[model samples]
Target: MPDKITIGGVSVDTRHWIGGQRVASAETFSDSSPIDGGTLGEIARGGPAEADAAVAAARDAFPAWAATPRAERARILHAIADGVEKRIEDLAIVETTDNGALLRSHRRGVMPRVAHNFRFFADWLLSLEHEDFDTRGHRNHVSWDPAGPCVLITPWNAPLMLATWKVAPALAAGNTVVLKPAEWSPLTASLLADIAAAAGLPAGVLNVVQGYGAEIGDALTSHPDVRRISFTGSVPTAKHIAASAAANLTPLSLELGGKSPLLVFADADLDLAVDLAVEQYDNAGQVCLAATRILVEDTIAEEFTRRFVDKATTLRQGDPRDEATDIGPNIHARQLEKIDGFVQRALEAGARAVTGGHRGDGQYYAPTLLTDVAQDSEIVQEEVFGPVLTLQTFTTEDEAVALANGTRFGLAATLATGDPERAERVTARLVAGTVWVNCFFVRDLQAPFGGSRLSGVGREGGTWSFDFYCDLKNTVTAPNGFTDHG
Candidate 1:
């Protein structure tokens, strides 16, 4: 890697994108890369005033943006996709450098999806069917219209992708957005503003504000002008947003964290199960939907634990830039210490580490597994958000289901079993937004993504997202031949 990552042969923007321009402020914060603890750049410090300006701009632009023809909106989204495709490498580098995600994974796995999100929503918009019904006494037409100015707050991990997941559909539905990216991972989001502008996104249609949440989160989420708020982060933060949004009776879509379970049945393919478990270490297990809980059938638990521990020990941890590196450092020193705390506490509580345990050098924690953990313990019930996996055994499928749903979160769950009938049955019983049968983290763009209970309030992707971003209205008309005979 070089001294600094650049985009378009220039130093990347680290300021807020508000009112169709990059706004720099004297008050700023240092953005550091997790790779080597180097300062990446300084980002603008935005507070209530900045958020107000962005919301005002979006509110001003909403009428015209909302009225823009579906075809025209689709065309602009396609252009944005094209712009992203052309600069895939530049954007990918920014994401990896700022967020410490693996460059190899992002370039190949995430960049394409960035463009695809726009395309997917754009196409979905054009193909949507406006409901029209003809009856003997009256005619009725139901249509979806933009919900007006909205707030989109994204988290640090997978900032670009998660923001895109909300922004694409919101824009496609013609809702102007004031996006506040997590302060730690603001570079790539800043680049997206340039891409959108280059693609002809009208001024004030998409605004980005970067700062600490405490500085701007309340003002953004509670603003009367913002009709909707979509957030992806911790459950505690979501609750705060919920209370603030309620001040305006604003609709909110919250995708919170999870302690998701990956069930390994007695009849599961052991090799495949091991492979999936290892893959969960991607992003150092910072992902909200990762399989943090490894619940295996009692009959096969011992064998599975041995294989899993051996495989985890082999995973290389180093600088993410290295193609051979399997696990990168946590986002920051604080996260590393947090992971260490969880592991230490579990060990002290009598849970045994199967293989790798303890924190390594410089924000790196070895992939850890803890067996003999109680079902109700903090290690098993809480979201560690690290590469630490808690192992638990279940004697029956009922027990597996109970253990999986024991946590406050119900974001997602995965099960590996040979019997299709049993898979579907268990899937139905699990109270989660998404369920995977014999697979891990498999997503379909058209399928709804979210959680039940505290995982999230509303679904995203496909029609569900469109519904959230748009307000539905029904128009009732008099019969064709009937005039207004007041």
Candidate 2:
């Protein structure tokens, strides 16, 4: 392996960006591409000291940034959008190499979407309706101000996009930020620091700390200067962060893990349902909102299973760089093992793999379909987080809804029904943050996105994001009655 990996025509020896400088640490760790197991490069391993420096930088910059006019903040955000758009291709390549998501999705879907997020949030601020009212002869003025220094911890699944999801709104609301990208995928986040700086974000206003969550995350969340924390990762880790935030009584927004379900009714269009299945398994099924649990009505279960397995068999698992590839490798060796273990356990418990079920070389797993699986089986109950699907049959509408909401997660779900009334009725009963009636994975920039139960704690995107990243202060004024009192 080379001493340094070149991405986007630049050599990488990863370092944290603190106070607008690329700062190195005494300790560092190797970062490799999950695609081919090739070494990407070495990245600084930040400890508490580094975290402290990042928090301190954000703290120093917060007041000035907060005091910046909202219109100016919106302008900078638009500049950020332009910067992101300018480097979209390069950013997409870096993200794909680091995270093993399909290059096409990263380039054509995620990167552009991230740029759009900045634009969306920027326009939202410009079009905002500031609230003011009068009651009891007193005028109350409500306005939003930056929520001070905030720490954003994003997952590796879709590093640039997910990080932007938090960063855009936070910056748009005039908050200084310290970002901790997942160790597994830190390249793009590092690149983002450069983009933001070039877009004219002030020094110490935005910083990127690249390191493992355990060492640096604790310090950032527990830092007294950090007023708010927004994290996207596993439920267990979110819980730990929540605990840490409690020490300072800091506010938090967590978008945790998900084991979402997709239900197919007997009256649904089978072809469309199959298409939805394919969409759910997109991104190698690593998406937190992917449909892992498929509940098909008993009457049509047999045909649905056959068609689903047929479609699953045809999915292409190959080099992520290949635009034609449908499934990419797992993010790491450990993740590959976890996905394999879950499928193996289900097989041991009498689940049948009608099509692809086994692991391939170098962290690649075949798109799998497991039928005849018990609802209580680990494969159905837990998140496999690979291109694997488990099928179960339900005899009644209530039963289908029950199976869909059976998991501890409530991130997202999809229900397919020909009858519009049935679709509405079932959607109302499904316990998820977002429910699609006849489609899967449809998203809107204006819609609020988050989860229920263990999935997440707060909503993001649209106005919800603005609310979370800023503090709404209400001021009241009234006429004095001093003359009458005297």
Cα-based TM-score, every candidate: 0.96, 0.96
Q: Which candidate is the best by lDDT?
A: 1
Off by over 4 Å in 1: 1-10, 134-136, 481-486
Clash count in backbone of candidate 2: 0
For candidate 2, what is the TM-score? Answer: 0.96
Q: What lDDT tens digits, residue by residue, belong to model 1 across residues 1-486?
A: 222346335467777888898787658887888887888766788898998999999999999999999999999999999999998888887788888888898889898999999999999999987768877778788888899999999998998888999999999999999999998888888889999999999999999998888888889998999988999998999999999988899999999989899999999999999988888898988999898899999999889988987788899999887899889888987788888888899999999988667988777888888888998898998888988888899999899999988998899998888889989889999989998888887787899889988888989889889889999888888776667799
| Superposition error at 314 for model 1 (Å) | 2.1
- lDDT for model 1 comes to 0.88
lDDT of 2 at 481: 32
